[model samples]
Target: MAAGAPMGAGNSSRIYKGSGWKLLFPSWIIIGIFLLAPVLMMGVYSFLTKEFRGGVIWQFSLDAYDQFFFDRGLFGDEPPRLEWTYIGIFWRSIWQAGLATLACLLIGFPTAWFIATRDPKSRSTWLFLVTIPYWVNLLIRTVSMKFLIRDTGPLNEFLLSIGVIDAPLGLINTNFAVQLGLFYSYLPFMVLPIYAAVERYDFSLSEAAADLYAGRWTILRLVILPVVKPGIVAGCILVFVPSLGAFLAPDLLGGAKTFMIGSLIEEQFKGNAGNWPFGAAASMILLTIVMCVLLVYARNQNKVEAR
Candidate 1:
């Protein structure tokens, strides 16, 4: 404990961090083993061809990526719709996730604006309201969606009792339901980031715009949106990334009518039972997709910040 004693490794570690150059062991180890390793493996896996027994043949082949992109099989009519099916699912996942992200943006932006602009006491209350669902389990939320929208459920019952339809309408197991489910589930994600941006904003900028003869719409369009874009980016990343991999919401809400990439990859793991190589390939494909989109987003962010 002597002040003059030689500092131990722990002390040196603390000293190095306190001086602001990090040498964090756990962080590096976690990233190396968990994040980087898996991604590298996936990239490798994506390039390899599937074998007869559900394992990779360990030869470098572009066949996996080729099949993924072209969605073609080894032969024909005898052909299962792998090519167009995979492409369709890929586009659908991206499209639906985009819709969900848009919905999240529309709903979350104004709410976050309201919450961020409130008085301190009111702000806390609103934030608490916004975040209360986090305490509820995610699976529970997705499952509960069915009852609310089902034929015998409240929505259909209400509609029918009031003669809104001749019969219980086919609301469940559709793209509309999937979109609603994902949007509702990820709404909190969009709100938190936008709220953070909104709260940190300089209100006087709006006032300045007003004094400069800019109207509310112009002020919002030119001044407000540009500044809060980082938050918009963050919100999109939060909502869209997870929505891409969300199998359960689509499965439960859409009742297996629509197949998401997540569900398809999941099938390789379990449904195709022992088709490990194909399953692994599918997983890798999904991982690559999520990574590519994020990389583009990150690059765009850097370009904006640099300017």
Candidate 2:
């Protein structure tokens, strides 16, 4: 009976281990269906020939990528010349996203630090206030922003009332308005991560540095920032990546006059262009850029861990 008991325990242990592996199957299936399958489909579509209206022809062609890198003119019979239109669009998107990220970092860092230093009972209230605006639909918030900043909007009226300016600010449909929209939309992403990091930091380090005759700037530069840098990077990535691919802000805020990468890709499929292969190619390129950014971050993180 003693030998039989050991055999039964071993059997049960094996059964438990088998069930654990079985539990992972659902997650694997979800990732395959939702993530990997779409990316693979896009990759294949990007290489395929484009149909006239809205589909792929399935035959292999480099025309989509060729069009992006080189312009063959309206007839496609002319000798190819370097394309600057798409390149300009990409540069504009990068510039907008970078500026938005910088704005968020400047505002968010101070706001996060203030929250972290608050009394424990008040911290939650402050966080709640920060997130409350996001509970409303994003489109609505964006439209409300439009109302506030337009030439005839309350902002201009208020300025006029105070004699701050002779005329309307003319903020609507401008790059500055788009930047404002992007900054408003993603500021929370910056603040929450930074707040979490600052909350975990030890103030004793600052005191110790001060005791050693370190100035306020020196302590902040050398001691505080290093410990909280991961959170700052995370916040920037969160803001910048989404801003790079954002279409709504550019569409509504910029009056659809300027095309960011997101707007350009969206227009290919949904607008009169009806070029599926080109859209897929653009998506693939955007995905590659995002992946490269993530890869660089991961490598830096690995180096930090190694040290």
Q: Pick the candidate with the highest TM-score.
A: 2
Query: For model 1, what is the error of residue 193's alpha carbon versus the real structure, in angstroms, after optimal superposition?
Result: 0.5
> What tens digits encode model 1's per-residue C-alpha lDDT throughout 1-307?
5566676676557554563336667788999999989877776766776765556677877766556656344563244344676778878888889999999999999999999999877898999998898798888988888889988999999999999797988789999999989998899999999999999999999999999999999999999999998998899899999999888889889865578977877766563254455556777777778889889988987887566
**Candidate 2 residue pairs in backbone clash:** none
- Global CA lDDT computed for model 2: 0.91
CA lDDT of every candidate? 0.83, 0.91
Off by over 4 Å in 2: 1-22, 255-257
RMSD of 2: 6.7
> What's model 1's TM-score?
0.83
What lDDT tens digits, residue by residue, belong to model 2 across residues 247-304? Answer: 8888888865557998888887885457888888988988998899899999999888
Of candidate 2, the 10-residue stretch with the lowest lDDT total is 1-10
Top lDDT prediction, candidate number: 2
Off by over 4 Å in 1: 1-23, 47-63, 70-82, 255-257, 271-274
